[model samples]
Target: MLKFVLKRLLHMIPLLLGVSLLTFLLMSLAPGDYFTTLLQNPQISPDTVARLKAQFHLDQPWYVQYFYWFKSVLHGDFGYSMAYKIPATSLIFARLWNTFLLSFVAMIMAWAVAVPLGIWAAVKKDSWIDRACSLIAFVGLSVPDVLLSLLALWFAAATRWFPVGGAQSPYYDLLTPMQQFWDRVHYLILPALVLAASSLAGIMRQMRSNLLDTLRAEYVTAARARGLGEGWVIWKHALRNAINPLLTIFGYSLASLLSGAFIVENIMAWPGLGRLTMEAFFAKDSYLVVDSVVMATALLVMGNFIADLLLAWSDPRIRLK
Candidate 1:
């Protein structure tokens, strides 16, 4: 396992470098950069603009600029955010937790709800309960995230039941620890629900299908023939095998939630990496954009790596590979 993990980590280095290179090249193709608007300011002379470009290596060829940026990255420097006037790493770190919090909450909610409901649906196959779950999953899968976010905002507005947006109330610090926790939860509900709803459908459907298939397997029949209780046969034997695939899904879902959170965060004012990335892109903060992209890609790669590890652990057959 240690060898496998080390190999995956080693593989991540080249993957991140390639992603960063592609992002840098794409950003360069855009007409202007962070300093382009500065040139329009009559108060800022051409020399000042030129000097700024030189300072950031923006005046160099794309490959040369990438070389310097890559060199900085190797040394654990993610480069400066021209727009925020801070280290790109610091800016990303500040928002990274917020994004992680939202995604984590949503992921937990999704799995908790999805797994049981899916199992039940498969167990009760063709019953009204199963039909109801299917209907809910259909609606969840059918609705667009943006529309759901807008509806959630509208509901929050009309009922005053939830905060329409933001991660916390302005006076969050003034509250006691317990109060702060609930305050965060309260602020988290709308966006988290929005994010979770998007994922719950697919997971539930996959679970239902996997369980159904597992239930029909010859081993399940053999377990039943061995006089195992129906509950034990289904829950212990079938469920164990059925759930293995979802573990793989669990890994990818984190990165997907992070990516999906971008639109939701912007729409709902969640104040996360997605919003920061959007702001950076609009400002043409090259280094910041590159860093954000690299960060997200790393999450994706790591998520899959974790998934592979989980897959190997859950099913010993995979470890041999």
Candidate 2:
């Protein structure tokens, strides 16, 4: 297992290099840059733009510029964000925690709710509970995330059940620590629910299908024939095997949340990496854009790697090759 993990870690070096290089090339080839916006301003002289370009090594060959950027990356410097007038690291990291927090909570909420609901639906089969779960899942799959977020925002406005937008209440600063924590939680609930809704549906359906199939298997029949309680047979024997495939989805879901959160966060007004990435893209902040892409790709790769490890652990038949 250690050897397998080490091998996977080693492979990530080339994968990450390719990802970073591709992002760098794509950004370089893009028509406008961070300076392009400044160029459009009437007051900013061309000479000033030239000076800024030189200062940031933007005039250098793309390949040369990449190496310079790469060097800074090695030293934990993700280059300066001209648009925000800050280091890319600082800007990204500040927002990264919020993104991570939101994604993590949303993921937990999704799995916690979906898994049990799926099991119940499968166990109940054609019962009313199963039908209800199916209807909810259908709604989840059908509704686009942007629309869901907008609707959630509207609901919040109407019911005052949640903050309409943003990561905190206006009274957060004056609140006690516990109050502050709850305030953040209150703000988080809407966006997290919005983020989790679609994924929860997909996961629940997948779980239901897998569990149903597993329950019909010969092993499950054998377990039943051994006079085991239905609960024991399903939970102990069937569920373990049924959940193996879900590990793969669990891995990819980590990265998908980043992209999905971009839309949800924007609509919900949650300050997170998604919004920052979008802002950086439109501003053509090359360093910031590259950093964001690289970070996302890294998360994706890590998620897959973790999934592979979990799958192997869950199913001994899937030994690392």
Candidate 3:
């Protein structure tokens, strides 16, 4: 297990490098940069702009800049954020938690609802309950995240039930710890739901299919012949095998939630890494963009790695591989 983990970690290095290189190349193709807006200032001279570019290696060729940036990255420096005027790492870490919190809540919400609903639907296959779940899943799969976010905003606006945006109330600091927790959760409901909704349908459908297939397996029949209670046979035997595939999906879903958060965060004004990344991208903060992309790529790699570990642990056959 340790050897497998170390191998996966080693593989992540090249994957991250490739992602960073591609992001850097694409970012370079965009016109202008963080300094462009500064150039328009009447008080700032061309020499000042020149000095700024030189200081940040913006005047250098893309490869040269990437080399210097990569060197710093090797030493645990993520470079500076031109827009935020801070270390890129610090800026990213500051927003990282918010994104993680939102993604975590959304993941829990999705799986908590999806798994049970899927299992129940499969158990009652072809019944009204199954059909209803299918209809709901279809709607969830069909609706885009952007539209869902807009609808969530509208609902928040019209009903006044949930806070429309941000992660807490304005007076959050004054609240008691318990109140503060609930305050954050109150604000969390909308964006988290929006983020979870997009993935929930797919997971539910996958779970339903996997469970259905597992239930029909010869092993399930054998378990039944052994006189295992119906519930035990279904929940313990069938679910154990059925859920293995979803563990792989579970890993990808983390990265998916982060990517989806980019849009949901912006639309809902939720302060998170995604919103920060978007801001940096528009400002053409090259270092910040590279850093954000690297961070996201790391999350993706880690998610898959963790998933692989879970897959192996859950099924001994995989560990042998």
Best by lDDT: 3
Candidate 1 vs. true structure, TM-score: 0.96
Instruction: Name the runs in model 1 displaced over 4 angstroms.
Output: none
User: What ordering of candidates by TM-score runs from best to worst?
Assistant: 1, 3, 2
1 or 2, greater by TM-score: 1
Sliding window of 10 residues with minimal summed lDDT for model 2: 294-303
TM-score of 2: 0.94
Residue 158 Cα positional deviation in candidate 1, in Å, after optimal superposition: 1.9
Tens digits of lDDT, candidate 2, 1-321 = 789889988998888778888888888887867787788899999999999998888988778778999999899899999899989998888788888888889999999999999999999999999999999999999999999999998999999988898888887899999999999999899899999986899999999999999999999999999999999999999999999989989887887787889899888889888888888888888888888877777777887898898899899899896
RMSD of each: 1.5, 1.7, 1.5
Error of 3 at 33 (Å): 1.6
**In candidate 1, what are the lDDT values of residues 121-226, reduced to their tens digit?**
9999999989999999999999988999999999999999998788899999899999999999999989999999999999999999999999999999999999
Ordered list by lDDT, greatest first: 3, 1, 2
Pairs clashing within candidate 2 = none
- Give the per-residue lDDT of model 3 (tens digit) for 77-145: 999998889898888887888988988899999999999999999999999999999999999999999
